[model samples]
Target: MFNLAAKPFDYLIVGAGFAGAVLAERLAAGSGKRVLLVDRRPHIGGNAYDYYNDAGILVHRYGPHIFHTNAERIWKYLSRFTTWRPYEHRVLANINSKLLPIPINLTTINTLYKLNLSSEGMQVFLAQRAEEPETIRTAKDVVLAAVGRDLYEKFFEGYTRKQWGVDPSKLDKSVTARIPTRTNTDDRYFGDTYQAMPKCGYTRLFENMLDHPNIKVMVNTDYREIVKSFRHDRLIYTGPVDEFFDYRFGRLPYRSLSFRHVTLDRPQFQPTAVVNYPSTDVPYTRITEYKYLTGQTHDQTSISYETPCDEGDPYYPVPNPENAVLYKKYETLAAKTPGVWFAGRLATYRYYNMDQVVAQSLALYSQLSELDGSLAQDERTKQSIVA
Candidate 1:
């Protein structure tokens, strides 16, 4: 047991999200170190937070977070905190008054063109239409190389523009590469080996993970102020890297989102969990139904319409050459800054899923453990020399 009154906390973690929580838990349990975990938000779980609505239906406050990963170690690590509710995510894109499977699968092509295209026929059609660039540069090249101009214009262009607040041509190839074009009829959004939701909720899983005696949590507390008020040996920052360095080089661009949540008397809002609107007229990119994700049954259903914006809460880091250059400046600065380690999506300025964030946190913990062990050994050697 740790005596918080006697010993100061060894580490002070900035965000109470997956990165902060996972690192805090590991440091506290593994090294027997006291940790002070803080978040500016009133609650934990960061973007993955979910709660029950007035209708008694579980709804993700910040759009939807579907947990999907192929990493066995990541799966096993997270499984310790929460039981799994096996879920395979499916998404549909509303194009030309018709809903088609996203990722431009065989079904998506057949449905959109009103043609019976087999797997082989679909490949041939895509190849004939595809305009492969000599050197693929941007997000535009990725989609154009795979599905061609027509399908890219219809399904990706407007949606990408609306979602990122920029044209796909301006964004990095990795942005569109995240979504793959498939020849098979597999309608599932992600081809991850393990796909599931936490049985109780993401919040519950977080609560379980942070229940250690050595860890102290402070919600609605800013780390900046806490650093001024208290003393800590090390810092684990999961906030924006640019902000951490006070935008030394420049403010790295980030795409934010605004969600309009509505609870309807109807049992279901959409056909599936998420429906993407690829048309420019729609204004919003996608509408997500929570029950499909939570597997919750209720008389009334809750849904949220996601509208991308320039400012709200930073949801996605804008991936582009200019932003990459700016982030590199901050990355160099972070490396020079001692006793402070950065992790997670915002800190690293990368688009990472839930499991990826957890995996990253675990990896960071291992590195910290090694560093701590070396420091302890040096201290012991110094004390022996003094003796």
Candidate 2:
């Protein structure tokens, strides 16, 4: 048996993603504890990894991750690592051989329904166009209520069906309920107080954050193999809760994505950062031009087309009744497991943005520290009795 006493680490954190890195930083910096962060993948930034392509253009290797949040604390915390670059994410949808703004705005509805009406007229038209449902409960219900059956089937259904690998009709109300219909012509994707990307890039920002002397990172190392040997007072796990339990109850359902990153020998490919393809025939959800987000005026640019696939790394949790039930079982098991604390997207099984992850990790760190102090005091009392 590997001796746990041989290793010299205070905290063992799983998955060097946002949650692990942030927690490690807090424990090491705030509490002055030695920390070891491990990731199964041989990378630091996790899914938000960015690198320069052959064209010398900074590109999102996984997919586009635009940092936008309303949380002031999160913005202030992230500002310590890297300088912010102003980035407003705009989305275009290719429909009926024309590229148009999304969110089914006045222009979108007018072009889609072929109505030459003013903003007020568009609002009135949409009132008539909107489907009157008794109660909106499912994804279909929520979308159908905003834009009528015609627009719902045309814009949301096919795209969502391909993206989640489930019929929109079967999805929960919250799955697609956030999408809003606009009478005015506001084409911006998100409405957040802090909407910007790192000027240098996300990887560098993460690198700077995790580069502290008190923090130790082990990439391409599974926690299971090392946890038996490594000596740590506490654990901060950011990996899947199901994985932590070895999926004893059952695997919580998660949606995975496949990305096809390509390089184009031009300054730009599309006009905007992203173009949503809301059709099953397209085979891809959206195409993101990296130059738009990076603001790099290179001779050539890079783009990534997202194709929803079954087999890849788990990205998003499928928020359905069956998965919810399974997750509840995992939650119960996670609570029972002593010395292991869970946080982050996969562990919590929630759809979280970057800033949200950082904020959640910070909160988790505070709780973990308090728990550690209490446990240390209890252990010291027990040792005094023996002495």
Candidate 3:
């Protein structure tokens, strides 16, 4: 167990990601409380950390995390951290060595089917080929409904199987439903109102978020070891909820990631920053080139290849009915745990992007602060005693 150097804090926040950062900022700035933010990683920004690579290009440490959200509050909140760059994410799929626009757009259809069909014609063609699901239950239902049997089988099935270690037919519909299909030729991946990356980089943004003097950061520290000793009146547990209970019920299933980052002595690799290899034959799911997102020009560039492995850092929760059932059990166990509020992707066991996690953390912080009157009363008592 890693030992602490100093005294405990007023608020002990686990995981200095979006959840802990938001809560720490709120309690430290708003409540005037001392908050200690801890993370197991060596850095602050959870999966959204970005910094200048060896080639001096701003590179996303993890896979590409494009900030896109329809939530006005989320957009406004992150706007404080860094300036926004106008970037709409476009992705390509490498199928049989031929690059095609993802989401099965009109252009993709025309290229794939070898027919110069217009938008309307493409729509009609897809309707003819699309398979109507019996009940529309799984990821298979979602893909078949959006595209068709042929497109679904070609693009999604193999990818889904390799990515999640499960057949699309057995997974939740929302898993594949995330990939949108368009009648028009809009090649943008997300159809959100706001989509952009930080002009300075995500690491700087996180640094700004947790720069408050009242907040203390302890990186490479697990919450399990020193949580009990923290002199905090309230605790925010943002790590795995099941682990907190010592897996009294059972270990919650988590889908992990093994990223293979390669630095090439080339200006560019692919046309876009992201290229999805939706084939089982390929060991990796997607390859993200850093320069495309940052618009940085250099002789060499760094790219991260996302390989969905069964081990390494847990990135996603396998969305299935059985997992949901287990999550509910964990939730119940979490709720019963005193002085601990579970938040963030890992704690909640939900797959959240950077923007979603920020928005969620912001909202959750407000709710927790407003949950009880003791916090307010304690502050008042401190002020009165000071007087």
lDDT of 1 by residue, 107-152 (tens): 9888888899889999899999999999899999999999899999
What C-alpha lDDT, on a 0 to 100 scale, does residue 93 get in candidate 1?
Answer: 92
The most accurate candidate by TM-score is 1
Reference-based lDDT, residue 187, model 2? 85
Better of 1 and 2 by lDDT: 1
* lDDT of candidate 3 over 43-99, digit per residue (tens): 998887877766677887778888899988888987877898999999999878889
lDDT of 1 at 385: 100
Candidate 3, which segments miss by more than 4 Å at Cα? 1-8, 372-387
Off by over 4 Å in 1: 1-4
* Candidate structures ordered by lDDT, highest first: 1, 2, 3
Every model: Cα RMSD to truth: 1.2, 2.9, 3.2
lDDT of 3: 0.83
lDDT of 1 at 22: 96
Model 3: residue 371 alpha-carbon error in angstroms = 2.8
